[model samples]
Target: MGTGANCVQSPYHVTGSTWQTTSTHFRKQHTPHSLMFVCFSVGWVQGSTDFGVGFNLALDYGLASVYLENGTTVDIAKVEGGQVYKAAMRLNDNNIGMINGRTTYSRSEQINFKQSFLDNYIYSPNRLGGDGNGNNARSRALSLMLKALKTATESYLDSKISNAEVVVPFPASESYLHDLRQAVASVSLHMPMSAQPPTGIIAARAHGMYGKCFDDLDLQGHDKSMKNDPEQLILTIDYSRAALTALLVDEECGVFENRRVIHDTRLGLNGLHQLGSITATDLLETALRNITQLPLDDGNGAGLKYISNLVIIGESAGDPRLHDTLRRVLSEQLEPVTTVKSGFSPPIDPVFAASRGVAWDCWDRMNFQVNE
Candidate 1:
């Protein structure tokens, strides 16, 4: 998506099947490549205002390149391209004809068949504001998301991918999955049973910590470490216009077993700024406090332990002051001296972390899974 709207599509690397950090164990158990990776069939698709449709034209304007733009130019992505472009891109099953005076636009121009309704369309219905269309609006939004996915999959493979395994936010509910399935059906895309998108924080951790591919050079003095400790765990907090989510991951096991919370609130970066530093601090502190009580399994029938690290990300984390405040507050509150980390995905906003995580997941599913 875009940094302005606070969505990340993290960059990923595929070394056989394992995602992010690789290990000797995974390497040793090599299996024949799965057909899933045979033709780049598995992919991740995300929408965003920050990632505008990229169009590059030569000086002669003879050779033109056009495709869904990623988080390259923030200013361009933030700009609302146009109502026509947006509406047309928000693909629905119905036609959106315009009657201007006595003349009407052609069917091709009026047809709502391409999905590009920005990133907001995928949100739950309640997250949708009082646009007043209600169910119709929600249905249309989901349709657009599916359309966008189809278009992205087709582009990524450079061919039509009839079957795909899609990634969604972690802890996606049955209803959300059902909606996605319907969208896939609407677009004539087949979703495999095994294909699933990991939650937002895990994906971020893979790119930021494990893969070490996440770029955060802009976050001066940011605390990002590549150390992996089995007994140690990390907490990741994600902020966006859609919601606030957190999770804990075991470094050694590479498993995200606990979900801190998925607070459904429209309070985005703008909302945080509006709430001022103190209120935001209190709100964040409340969320982090919940982590202190989370049970930690040491795998030896032993009791829980303190989280070793805490990483904060999303568009809101861009504010150095906010990042610092979060770090300080969490440090003061966590049981053990939790090292706080703040960083964004470099070359792209930290927003792409989720998308990249899913892409890597698809690659892993296709190439790494041993049918033992």
Candidate 2:
């Protein structure tokens, strides 16, 4: 690691992290940059847009993000339907439309949700550690959070959340997954756990950002190409509050197949409020180096050398400094000829990038099942 940054400067002094800025000044993303003003019922917001990613993570209640029916992501703070930095986001299940707004649920204004499904979903953005509660009995805090979400959701919908899907960290131990499942079941809730990487893949699929599945395309994105070009190698970097995860994924048709994983538990955006104390460059450089060095599964397809597409998510991924550092690392560590692909324009806010993707998958399955 680069021994830590001596003095970190504000992002205002730096240029835009990439040609495609994920949002406005990346620095502001450190806090709950969004507090949507829409109806949200039975949603959870922990450190970052919660896949509710991890356990007992501290949360900034100032801004909360949720994904609506049309794949729109918004944060609502200090208002009805959604509250920020003060309490969990809550919306009247029946009165989900036009909460505290002049526009009542006119026929055209209301979203056409599946009769059995809720219309809105919560997406935790960034940061996941210390939930204002101390670190002891961490899992207990997570269980309570889920339990509360369950109660609030059921109370409003007058219907059970038949399916509560959660995105856990990639490569979670079997025991941890079991404990999580037990906790959800203990609260009379059913949660299906998915590894973190799939959440990103689903998000990418929803946006069609990586191109249609199972076809020959250029080295990057979904845009059509004439030549039988090499498959796109998308490197997904999730810089979250508790950890930094790099997933090397190959396009398997339209879906993503995880080829490798690199994790850095020591270096995260929220190193326990020690963002300024640590040197992000050193840790980032180390992580990126490891990613490039990992071997493919016995040369199944193109190696890391062909990683032409980059999809960076997580609250920290929005940092201008981190973005700058990432560019620097890619240029210095990778082959001189390698050109890291920048420019990500997803359909929804990065905050709900993963959550929206998860919902899209669920929505498709539900539609299929309901139709059947």
Q: What's each prediction's clash count? A: 14, 30
Runs in model 1 lying further than 4 Å from the true structure: 1-139, 152-158, 163-165, 195-197, 208-229, 274-277, 293-304, 332-349, 368-372
| Cα lDDT tens digits for candidate 2, 1-372 | 011111112211000011111211112222111111101112222112211111111121111223334544433221112222112211111121221111111010111234423222212211233233222122433466566554554454355443443443233333334445545656654444222233344344445544333345343565554344344556666555545656555553343444445544455565424644345566666666655553343245544445555666555557765677667666633332321122334335554455444433333333333334
How much is the lDDT of residue 50 in candidate 1?
16
TM-score of each: 0.52, 0.54
Candidate 1 lands at a TM-score of 0.52
Q: Given candidate 2, what's the lDDT at residue 91?
A: 13
Off by over 4 Å in 2: 1-139, 151-160, 191-198, 211-229, 272-279, 294-304, 332-347
In terms of TM-score, the best-performing candidate is 2
lDDT of 1 by residue, 113-145 (tens): 346564354333356542333343333444555
Cα shift from native, residue 337, model 1 (Å): 10
